[model samples]
Target: MALPAPTTAPTTAERIRSACARAGGAMLAVEGLEPAPTPVHHLLDDGSFATTVPVDSALAATAVSAGAAGVHAVLELTDHAPLPLREPVRSLVWIQGRLRDVPMREVPALLDLVAAAEPNPALLQVNSGITDSGTTTEPEIRYALLRLEIESIVVADSTGAESVPLSALLGADPDPFCAMESCWLQHMESAHRDVVDRLASRLPMTLRRGRVRPLGLDRYGVQLRVEGDDGDHDVRLSFAKPVDDVTGLSQAIRVLMGCPFLNGLRARGV
Candidate 1:
């Protein structure tokens, strides 16, 4: 089915934020340095991003000096899919701003916020002196909390590249399905060829002959990529109603596939 274009443009802020939240880590590069991309743990909240760097690192020194000199150092934070996929990169967010050192007194509160939102085990290492393997010892990794005061934000993805206003980014929320999308899509592609074929029946007659593959899923609907002889086409199979949770989403999928009764059965097993 051909879905109507949205009345307004899709904001990249939501996608960028979603990617960052799920990624947990990002490739951070400081401007004027030889592309020394370092893996930094990041958390995004309140229109800004907080990252941790080793106190003795060169990057930390550079950022502190730049912030003291009143120079806004351009920093780039790139987030991608953690799972193995054909196209791993979900989105890229370029942040332009001045980096300031977060005070030692405030680091615990900030870490608490991150732990509450993400609950990543890495945060436990930052908070308690325990590693993933449950080993406790002296603090081996001393980190300095740095806050990037976002001046400008730019995002790039399959749709295209665009700059997102900081206000919009702060106001927007990530897609409900962002965390589960990869696992669900990968499962559909690998284990459920029959189900995919059945869902393809909803495609328009003219385009049904093309190779239809599951492209993506969101709160609004499912997307299928049709690779035809001429070119590729994207068709959206919107649900009968908006879904906010997994139960509603399952019912919506069953309705879309013309098998409302399938809810009782083990659909995932199929």
Candidate 2:
């Protein structure tokens, strides 16, 4: 069965950026090196991305060795639901580009750029125990910072796969609530199964037979994952209109649940 598309779907750039914004970790593959998985990464205001790897790891060593002339690399980021499901991954973003080390002198500036996106505590430890006298107090652990210069990007999801232009990516902004999507979806799954059931009722009868779980939420709508005897299916329920903030999102969700005046989400910081 053909899944319904959102009436007001997010643009490809917005969707790709949103996926990256929510991704907790990504797989880094440098040329001639084994793919390394790192939980520490941040997308900068520019199209490039910054990531930290253990100082002693081969990936870090490769960055150090590559020096001014960087190595070709690809970073694969997956967007998945926080809650467990038959298929957790909703989308995959592959970033292809050059990878090189960010000099220690410039690390602070990089951190500032990432801080605007997420004030991760790991940023503080990235440059630990270094003194003003140009000396070093070796900390228990040290990390090497590497930056990826985005040459091209490709995004794939249930709908299909396509390459997004760099110009569009640089200009697009992720959904305002992308950062809160995981928390909101998880809350619905755990605290309000009835809400999920009501939304699932809107799906076709074939999908209703399967176990339905919340997959994603955006200004446009909510997506559900259906796990059935055959396989998994993704269905989107677009809002009557797109919402831009929490109040509008709450109203949209309540409308989806057939209770426009409901106050179930306001107390929870929806």
Candidate 3:
């Protein structure tokens, strides 16, 4: 059997237009959020501006006024479905109101928009990409982007990691911006340069394995100095992904501190 679209899938925008026979209507003031709870600002068209909620709202009133009738759902097609059941969605959103700036974006989490809209429940677009550094969820943005063709939305630049607000990302400026980890190389010879140098000078040519003692490994890596008849070497070794972070270095350092021979040297502040 075909997967069930919600038991109460909302009429399409075309259907809504036909039924209402109106160009653009309803100042559906969802009372409850802020004194004027931040108004739902989004572009009506390419140039038109409007709002879903009143401007001077305290933002607290939205909780009480927005009843259970929930925002309706609208569906449209994008690319061919990769799987039998999954159709690529472009965007999904309820026509709340015409606005100049609405907290919306092209992200992943917006899939929740599709699932939530089915129940016909008041879908609070809590994610404001900026001006509000709130919780982070990928799915919300995904679904929001899906409904952009028909539903009115306004997007903003990404604020990286310095998210301060829990509501939106647009209009918010983070002090320091952090991006995703781009690249990494495991077991880098470069990071082990010091240990390599130390070990090189000490490991004699054709050196036979002498009596073995269990020194210790540390955050820096492995600081096990081998005392062969040739010479003694205070060395550290590391084997870890190379990119950026304290893991390898930490292990190497720990090795220096934990190794009995090194510990004795360190205890004497050597």
Candidate 4:
């Protein structure tokens, strides 16, 4: 069946933020340097993000010198799908901004903020614990915290590419289901062939015969990719109502399947 046009386009800010959070890591590109992969610790509500690298690394040195030179070096952060799929890259969020070294005096406060948002073991490893003799062990690896002062954000995805305004990005929040989406999708594809078949029945009669696979799932709906003889078609099965919690999501799926009794069975597996 031809997919119905969406009443409102999905917000680019939310999608970009969620994609970055889900990927956790991104390929950071700076001019005159090879792109380096770094773990993203937090996406601040201010439309900026924070990452850390070795203090002695080339990237850190370049950023420090660039700031001194009054040259605002552009940095691009590219995030990809964590799971293997027909199309591995779900979206890319490029931040055109100036990279600056976080001052030593502010390091502790910044780390505290990052930990409050999303803590990583690596953050803890930055410093060694105090010994019984009241002496602190020096850290083996020293890290330099850097912040990207966002000038602009460009997000590219299946729908299309658009530049999101800073105000919009700061105002929007990532989708609630993002963190668990990969696990849910992988589980549906691997162990629930029968459930997938049932979902296919909801498609248009003409397209029901195609190989139907669970393409993705979000709070708004479930998506299926139909690999047909003609080509591929993506169909989105929206929930009867938007769901915010796991219990509501379960009921939404059952409603979509037109079989309320199947809720108990699906619950056990999901």
How would you encode candidate 3's per-residue C-alpha lDDT over 20-94 as one tens digit per residue? 221122223333321121122232223222223332232223322333322222221111111122212112223
Question: Sorted on TM-score, highest at the top, how do the candidates line up?
Answer: 2, 4, 1, 3
Q: lDDT tens digits, residues 1-270, model 2?
A: 997854677889999888877887788998677787666667676768888766777888888888989988899999887889877778899999999999979988888878776876666667577788978788766666789998999999888999998889878888999989888888999999999999988999988999999988999999889999989998889998888999999888888889855665444446
Clashing residue pairs, backbone N/CA/C < 3 A, model 2: none
lDDT (Cα, 0-100) at 248 in candidate 4: 86
Q: Model 2's lDDT to the true fold?
A: 0.84
Candidate 1 regions exceeding 4 Å error are 1-11, 34-45, 54-56, 67-86, 125-142, 204-212, 225-235, 260-270
Highest TM-score: give the candidate number: 2
- lDDT over C-alpha atoms for residue 12 of model 1: 69
Give candidate 4 regions above 4 Å deviation.
1-10, 68-83, 125-142, 205-210, 228-232, 262-270
The 0-to-1 C-alpha lDDT of every candidate, in the order given, reads: 0.67, 0.84, 0.28, 0.72
Deviation of model 2 at 72, angstroms: 0.3
* lDDT agreement of model 3 with the native: 0.28
**TM of each candidate vs. truth:** 0.74, 0.87, 0.15, 0.82
Across 1-270, the per-residue lDDT of candidate 4 in tens digits comes to: 998765322478887767766766665567777665566546676666777666677887887777634224444455544345566666677777777777767778888888987876657644335577998776766566777778888987666789988898888787888889878878887887777887889999989877777876777788888778876677889886567899888787877788767455654556
4-70, model 1: which lDDT tens digit per residue? Answer: 7642222467666666656655544565654323234454656667766665667777766765443
The CA lDDT at 156 in model 1 is: 78
Estimate the Cα RMSD of every predicted model relative to the unseen true structure.
Answer: 5.4, 4.8, 23.3, 4.8
For TM-score, candidate 2 versus 4, the one ahead is: 2
